[model samples]
Target: MTDPWNPADPGVLRLPSGRLVRGRGLRRPLDGSAPTPSYALYLLGRQPPPVTWEFRWIRWPDFRLPADRAEARAALTEAWERAAGERVEIACGGGRGRTGTALACLAVLDGVPAEEAVDFVRSHYDRRAVETPWQKRYVRRF
Candidate 1:
């Protein structure tokens, strides 16, 4: 049987360097009701089979990166480095605040002005992204 999620949907982003990543909300269901898979499983590749690209997750909540900035930096760095070889995704519960924050950080590593990352995401991803005040603050810091 064919799946309906369509992994190649617009929610996915491909940077200039061919890195593909998708932002998602953890609270949301995978097939509409099932539990989310393991972070490693989600990032290593798509579900089922045919692993198209590698992935990794950054477990940011509504408005916070990992308490350990070191871990957060490491994860982001690894994602940045792996961008050259495979797709890297950073997701959260709303795909807006947290995901957008992570994407903005990626943009910073990609040379986007730290000041403009939030606007960049607003223009490209969703105007509603970076919704929370803390989310905006996080973008500036990144």
Candidate 2:
């Protein structure tokens, strides 16, 4: 199904099940015209700013790895489920490493093989995604 928000942004990733979840850089300005997400997952080492949308923050360091695996998994799973019917977005500082890692995990949850999730994310979302080796390894483990 086409996303009601039509989040045609730079980091949107459309999963195999047609779930549309956008991945973006938190540093970038949110487009006022863009549709607000019903749920937003923020991957950051620091606390995220307060927002009107239902949100979750995963203690993920930029260019590094997620601080908590179990929590990250739960959050990503929740994000995956929400993406099926709601406007769900995953974002981080630069929106490449942590964001892409989360997106890859969501792809894995959506039935993409864990081994191929990172490549799938890169090919469909961003070529420079999943920046570090550990991040790619994390996707494989996801």
Candidate 3:
């Protein structure tokens, strides 16, 4: 298992179309001992400054899609569009669960069979990803 406190180095998940997206978890300092991380972070771009990719936040703890589905869709669409130009990142508190769910959705968008996405995330990213039973169900819905 990953340390959870320390996220893995980001990577590109190449879609069948040759586009790419990065995935990870943005978490509050685990040292604080808070119940959960503040929010999920999904960013689109390469390293360093002047990155062209966009960024979005999904509130954690609750784990609902953004209040504005359109915004969420727009974010994903932009990520999809920019996937060829830059790396896109999807993250949650533990680099699992919410992050995994979002990554699975990206896999769906990438043309991976939706049913296989959860397992893909588990095998590739972190085994603990998509932690909750409902979270696994959510990935299927994507």
Among these predictions, the greatest lDDT belongs to: 2
> How many clashes in candidate 1?
2
Off by over 4 Å in 1: 1-8, 16-18, 30-59
Q: List the residue pairs that clash in candidate 2.
A: none
Looking at candidate 1, what is the lDDT of residue 30?
A: 51
Top of the candidates by TM-score: 2
Instruction: Tell me the tens digit of each residue's lDDT in model 2 across 1-56.
Output: 33444646667788999888888888997888777788999999999999998999
Instruction: For residues 1-142, write the lDDT of model 1, one tens digit per residue.
Output: 1122223665555554445555665455457553222222122112323323444444444555555556677787776666555434556666777677777777788878889988877776767777777767766887
Clashing pairs in 3: 22-88, 22-89, 24-91, 25-92, 97-130
> lDDT of all predictions, in order shown?
0.59, 0.88, 0.55
Residues forming the 10-long window of minimal summed lDDT in candidate 1: 37-46
Better of 1 and 2 by TM-score: 2
lDDT of 1 at 76: 76
Off by over 4 Å in 2: 1-3
Sort by TM-score, best first. Answer: 2, 1, 3
Taking all chains together, each candidate's TM-score versus the true structure is 0.68, 0.94, 0.63
